[model samples]
Target: MLPYACAWIAKSKGFGKPRREGGFDNHDPRAWLSRLTDWQARANAAQANSFEALPFFIGAVIIAHQLAAQQAVLDILALLFVTLRVIYIAMYVAGLPTVRSAIWALALLVNVGILFLGWR
Candidate 1:
C-alpha cells in the first residue's frame, strides 16, 4: 500500500497537468506513466514488484497460521519481512539494483521457509 501510494504521488507529481479537462483524458495513460523520472520511475517499479509479492506473502502467513506454526517463528519472520520490504523500497528508490534484488530474494526465501515450516 505504501509503495502504491508512493507511485501514485510520483505519477501525479511527474505529470503536472492533464491535456484534457474531463475525468478521462484523450492522452494515453501509458504516455503519462512513462514520463516519470529518477526516483519516481523507481517508485513505480517498486510498487509493481510489491504488488507481485503480495500474494505469496499473504498465502505464506495464512498457511502458517492455519498449520499452527510456531508463534515466535512466525512473529520473527513477519518482522523480518516487513523490515526487508522497507529496505527493499529504499534500495529500489536509491537505484541499488543488486542489493534490492538480493533483499527481494531473501524475502522470497523467508516466505517459502514459512510455508515449508508450517507444513512440517
Candidate 2:
C-alpha cells in the first residue's frame, strides 16, 4: 500500500509538460518517472522494491500462522520487518546503497526465518 502510494507520489513529482505543448501531452507518466534522476529515481526504485518484497513477507506470515508458530514471536518479527523496511526506504532516498542493501538483506532474512520457524 505504502509502496503504491510512493509510486504515485513519485509520478506526481516527476510530472511535467513540454513548454511548447498544449494543456497536456500524451507522454507516458511512467516514461517521465523513468527519466527522473537522483533522489526521485531512488524513491521510485524503493517503491519497486517495496512491491517486490511484499509477497515473501505476506507468505511468511500466512505460513507461520498456518503452522501455529508462537504469536509473540510472529508479532516481534513482523514489527522488526516493518521497522527495517522503513529504514530501508530512508536509506534508499538518502542514496546510501550499502546500508539500504544491508537492510534489505536483513528483511529477507527475517522472512526466511519466519518460514523456517513455520516449517519446524
Predictions in order: lDDT = 0.78, 0.80
Give lDDT for model 1: 0.78
- RMSD of every candidate to native, in Å, equals 3.5, 3.0
Clash counts per candidate, in order, are 0, 0
Error of 2 at 52 (Å): 0.5
- lDDT of each residue in 75-111, candidate 1, tens digit only: 8998898788888888998999999999998998888
Highest lDDT scorer: 2
Instruction: Point to the candidate with the largest TM-score.
Output: 2
Q: Count clashing pairs, candidate 1.
A: 0
lDDT, model 2, position 3: 98
True-structure RMSD for candidate 1: 3.5
